[model samples]
Target: MKKISSKMIFGILTGIILGITMAAYAVSVPSEQVLYSNSATSETTVNGALTELLNLSQECKSRCPEGYTCTEKKLCKRASTSTLHTETCMTGSACHVQNNYKTYGHGDTITYGNISTTAGTLKAGDAFDCDVNGNGHYESDSERFYYVSTMNNGHMRADSNIAVLAYAKTSNTYRLSSGHISYNNYGNTSYGPQYALNELYNTTQWKNAPEIRSGHITDSSGNILKLNFSYSGYASRLLTYQEVSAGCSIPAQVVSYNSVGVMDSGGPLSYSCNFLLEDSNYSNSSNSVYYIWLESGVDGRNDSAFDIDTYSSNVSYDSVTSMNYARPAIEVPLSDIDY
Candidate 1:
């Protein structure tokens, strides 16, 4: 099984320790008028430079970070309002829009990606109806989906990737739903993470999305996204970790769940993990193995492994190994779907 290095494990444990013990939050609102820089609000450059730490609020006067815009005395992602646009094609076509956005927390900050849409067709018995068999579900020529992660609130906007539900096989023994990815680390190392995500990006309906041959995509602003297979990274795959690791600035917050059936915060996490981890029969199929990485480390006091329950919707874990699967996630602007 793929495993992480000992040093990597130590660093992850250290980072989590700092995350919990440090009374000051890296992005929390401050009392003083904090002078901030664009780099300070980065996930990739967690320990990067900042001459002065600025106060985090929507009401700041200065220019906020790249993905984030200043508003209400704090900093939030910029242009996130347009992350997902709904266009009902009254003219008998699939409803689609050109959604261009900087994927938060994956990679660089300036790279603005785009999505292309063609509009949904009329469901009233047209050639390609929403439901040809009359299942009541709109079966347009294609499905509409957000380019970004699932959560609605974060450093950047969610619903950025316009995707459709699809499926693909991993090993000869495993078949999983398309578009499955992990936001956090599995072991101390990425532990063979990128291959599955590469498969999802190349094999699924999102196959046509804007991406370079290097397994990376560039935005309109000329930023080159150089992503990596990372473990022991930050939490919140939606914006912070996914964006930074994917080569952008916007950070995604992980969906939090207080209970198995109850959702406290991260809905997209549940959607992706549940869809992929749960078998076609919904009975936790051992056929499709899943080895996911989590951003949050194990409470050192509890065990030697990390807390990976956040990665799977139905499965809980004290430890895992290589026979399992580790999925990676990335984003492209819905507008860039055509670009």
Candidate 2:
């Protein structure tokens, strides 16, 4: 009886050592951690915790909710909410955090929102994609690229309301809707920017243009969700010039009575279009990157137009005729589209 008891104890000890070794190996990779249930407690034994964590990993690829990020495929947290995302987020919208699998070189295909953009190679610093209007599918040109924008997923809406798993800087593009290209500040809305967005959504050179349509998500219940992927130009809804400027990360500047657009409530917001030249998103920081143009002498107000000299780093706003870049706020709701 003593010999049998000894044998049983030996087996248990051996198994315990082996499990600890395996668990250590499992979480050794940097930033990766074993998934633990919110209900897990310290009272749980080490062996029990390890066993549960290991099993749960196999059972679920990720426990992250939509718009939430899965850190190292273990720690799940809410994505950061910039002003742009907060303004555009719908009542029940939950934004997704950028997921750049550290294994970009080897992990499974990268899915930005609902689109499979980087199969493996196309390089990006953070694994974010921007082509949502056309579905980003260009068979003729296999080599695709993305604009590194200041915008994040919180402000992007998926095409046709399909839930996508990613967001890009262009999500701020929808801000164009706040003003009109043809008529600077028409009434209270910017019809010009809105027109451009519509053009992208409706007209396309390709055969199967991406449009708002019904899509499906493969959940455990296999439930089908109506993915209403559309651009909310002011989706961020941050109409105040200060709000937009801060969201765009523009350099601070002086301003007074700089009314650029009208408000939905009647009068134009005081600082709606306080245009500045220095805050463009491109690395070069030139007017070519992106900028906004206010209606010059329409009401005999300050011209507020600007021009950047690439050579001297000088900005001139005297001329009203010069065409300026329009930095609009946009939102993409990636709640639809299949995974």
Candidate 3:
């Protein structure tokens, strides 16, 4: 009805068109509201929405116990109390476990064949008896002698038939018999042998006594004969009549002998005999000797011998002044001997 203007009309139409375009753009834009059924667009919008929500949640106060704290990953955990416990914590992959023990008591005596100390420690003046093994009791006196039986346990007799007369002095405190005889006589003597207070002045009989010694004998034909001899010594003291009944025998020869020296005590003393024939008639016999002495400082008699064969049939011998002083004697074959 009034005067119309083209400029005003054009401005109005432009404003209306712009408003419509803004409304259309808002409606078409993607939103997190879409279900995953939308595939590509749904994953992108949902991730963006989750990130914004987490950031907002962190800004709020945590609702956990006083001793607990919220982790960066939005989880609550209690604080650890002890560092030691944590350090030693075991896992399924790591673990371990241990087991044997030993005991020393009575009936566990330290026995050296014929001689045995109490289950405890040994001291001076302890009285002991030397039985079948030739181990004698300890005595303060230097000049003491004992007759000890040296035999195998399996062959031991109640009568003490087999034994060696061993002597000892302060200067010679060890056994002087062969190791073979000493070892075999362990635990086989009855009541044990007592020590004689008097010192044995001479061992002439012991040294020259019947023994199987080994040596080479040359015949008149210049042929050497490897021989072993069992010869009796004349210097030996006569066995008491009672001793003879108990298996002791009289010496075959009589000769003056010297006292046993410290050097001659422990060793391999062997004597062997070979008869020399003059035109089929036996004329003379020779005995060879073999001996080895151990240089141990202890005073005692430790000796041994082998049978006809040097390599086998061995026996041990032990000589101690007293049962308390004796130790286990050893007799090993030359081929099987080891320290």
Candidate 4:
């Protein structure tokens, strides 16, 4: 009802415009507290996911035991302690023999070949508890062996993944069936060491031991012969000539005699063969003289196989029919040992 005026009209329009502007600003701008709360939730979600991923990566790593190292395959392996090789004389004692002997932190004798002696902790020369004589008793003096080497599962025996090679403390005599035979032929035949060892697997003497894996046999000339067994392989067989004389700088030889039939040469015993020499008391007793068979057969001579002659303390070859010491060697699964 008041008289119309420009100033009044202008004031009324200005107030309405200002009120609308303020309401639009209030709708668009959220409170500082609200903004901070929303931001925190987003950051928390992202950070939590990152933390979980880090935890998973850490859980996947493997921890190796003492005296072992972690291989690139994420498995545990035996670590060599020293370059120096030595033997421990365990004569007339609970442990019959120890080769490549190295004193562990604690002088502990593994009474059984089970999980108690963890495979990772076993170094070369560690005595493994086994039933050697088939007497139904796992005695240290009866059928025990000292570890000679450690290898991957498929390296030696296909079934024995992650295995250790063990050598006998003493020797046992066995006769190779009389014949003019080559290594390849002898290994395939039932009368040879290759098949003879497998036959023992069915007996108490080697019922528990893992069967031998077929391997190559090399002669003194570096010629290779396959031990293609008809069955899985040998159960308890003799050491290879290469393995026995591995440590020798001037390795011994295996040869056929001339028309007159005489050994052509002699050489130093290998570090491994040295162990057998001392344990057998070949140095002290003349009666202890004997020949030990090697897995290798003479390269050029089909009638002969390599042997360790006690008299000369060197490598030699003898007639396949000759009776020789069958020093059993076995590759056992790592899982059989206890930690």
Candidate 5:
């Protein structure tokens, strides 16, 4: 565990060059380490010394572990790609390359994190693994989610510390009970209307994801939905219109379905965005598709909430008490996710 430095390596190299020069031209010195030949040409001796230096440098570079390059500073880190040969080297000792480098990318599959997932990456529409019940197993249809967007403080590069928004990969039959998220001027609040979805978010969903820290989302009327635990924060909520259409090609079209799972009105709202259309798990069969609830309620409709029909990628609305599904979405730090 000895620390190697650039200055020390430089000093050793200087000594070797001076020793070789004296050994080639000066009177023979009785030293076991120095090899002196009377008939050898100076050019031959110089070439021999250069070959030894090359071997010495290569030996140290070979110790550098994967994902980490031995830097000129002799410090092991994940900053640059330059290797040990870019600088001088030590002859006998191995360069110390620390085992601390790891790479994270937009589509890199990770095994574990503060919240675990079997299939997931850092790209939009990618699988977001979350098991809500602490049962160690996720529902077959609801086992994964789509990463909708990256927040202001998030990133998708190597060694990045960030947070992203995740939406349910499939739909569920969770009902959105009726009422109104009413507020009074006297600081009194009523969660009775949005209570159904709130209960599911705060209690049932994301139960196993403790790393989903508190956050906030805005509504159509400039209202704020805090996902904090202190006041009335939700653990997992629905997506919004702006969120779904951020970098996607969502058209002005609308699609709808009845409570009995029948397409009643509107046409397909086929949308396309980064990797969203590339999800292999997305269903093409109508039987497995359902409407996904969004966080924002209809602009002027108090008893209704916006929803996206999975069958058509179309946006629509439904009564709060209707039997549509709740596709929960959450925000989590990228650092909390392991590579």
Candidate 6:
């Protein structure tokens, strides 16, 4: 309000001019205006961004749990939907189950001791009881006996020759022939395809020749001679003999006995019989006597024919005698006969 000095008045006028220049400069600065406008634009862009808006929309729709977003790159994961992950119940593999059951095929051949059999498809732990066949075994008395007789015919002395008496006995699967016992003072003996008693008896020691007459023998009184013999046509001669004792006593005489003279001799002279006798006794007692009657002669000759014609036809003979002192008789165990 008081009149100022000249310097003070000029200073006041300079201050007013400087203040107006500062305000105009601030308003006219383009950098500050551009900075404000850019800040606002940046805030608006963030609020309206496409990705952010999508995330918010998804969150509102509950597409994913809290703090999660439905993103194209990070989709929801789930359990596998493929069938390859499942297990199969049945498989065709060799060791696999079929219809919930196990099956097997033919396995390798297995042998146990002296027995063997065909092994077919079976379970791993399956077991079987085996019995072997085709091994030589006793067929029957008739078959064995017939076989021996057929072999011995015309080769062994009928009257002096010991008969092959065969008894039925259970043998292994390999013994299928009749066993014999000799009337000689020899111990028990055996003969077969391997042990031929007929052959042994025909040797020089026996001095007896086989009569090829297959007819029954009779005493001078026309009584049929008692001779128990097997029907086996495969008989073999005694290969060896072991003297046991004199003739078997009455209790033991079923096999050991003397043979009467042959039908050709007509003298009825008893011959000393020493050989294995057939096991075919009339009864269980050893004293049982067996009679012999010519059933068929070799070469198809009648029993009455005695000449060479008859002898030629006689395949085997049945000779019986009385009071002949043949030493101990031999016996062939049934276990040794080979079919």
Which numbered prediction scores highest in TM-score against the true structure?
4
Clashing pairs in 5: 162-334, 179-193, 180-193
Order of models, best lDDT first: 4, 5, 1, 2, 6, 3
Please identify model 1 stretches exceeding 4 Å from their true place: 1-187, 190-207, 212-281, 284-321, 326-330, 337-339
For candidate 4, the C-alpha RMSD (Å) to the true structure equals 21.9
Q: Regarding lDDT, does 2 or 4 come out ahead?
A: 4
TM-scores for all predictions: 0.27, 0.25, 0.16, 0.47, 0.40, 0.15
lDDT of 1 at 101: 17
Off by over 4 Å in 3: 1-143, 150-162, 170-339
Query: Ten consecutive residues with minimal summed lDDT in candidate 1?
Result: 121-130
Residues 198-289, candidate 5, lDDT per residue (tens digit)? 42456444555543343333333424433322323455655555555442335333334467754356423323232221221123232333
lDDT of 3 by residue, 1-339 (tens): 243332243343345345455766667533444322121122334445345335534643455423334433211011112210111212222211100111113223111112213333221111222221222222213212223222222111112323323222211223343221221233311111112111112224233222311222211111222132111222112112122112212121111225754322211111111100001101101211111111011112222111111111111122322121221211111121110
Question: Which lDDT values do the candidates have, in the order given?
Answer: 0.27, 0.26, 0.22, 0.44, 0.40, 0.22
Weakest ten-residue segment in model 5 by summed lDDT: 75-84
Q: Per-prediction RMSD in angstroms?
A: 25.2, 19.4, 39.3, 21.9, 20.4, 46.6
TM-score: the better of candidates 2 and 4: 4
lDDT of candidate 6 over 1-339, digit per residue (tens): 244432242244345446556877566533223211121123223223333445545665556544444443211011111210111222122211122233222231211111112232111111111111122232222212210111122323233223232111111111233322122222111111122222222213312212222332222222333233331332222211111111211111112223652334211100111111222121112322232112222122122211111111111223211111111111222222221
Q: Cα miss at 148, model 2 (Å)?
A: 11
Cα deviation of 11, candidate 6, in Å: 99
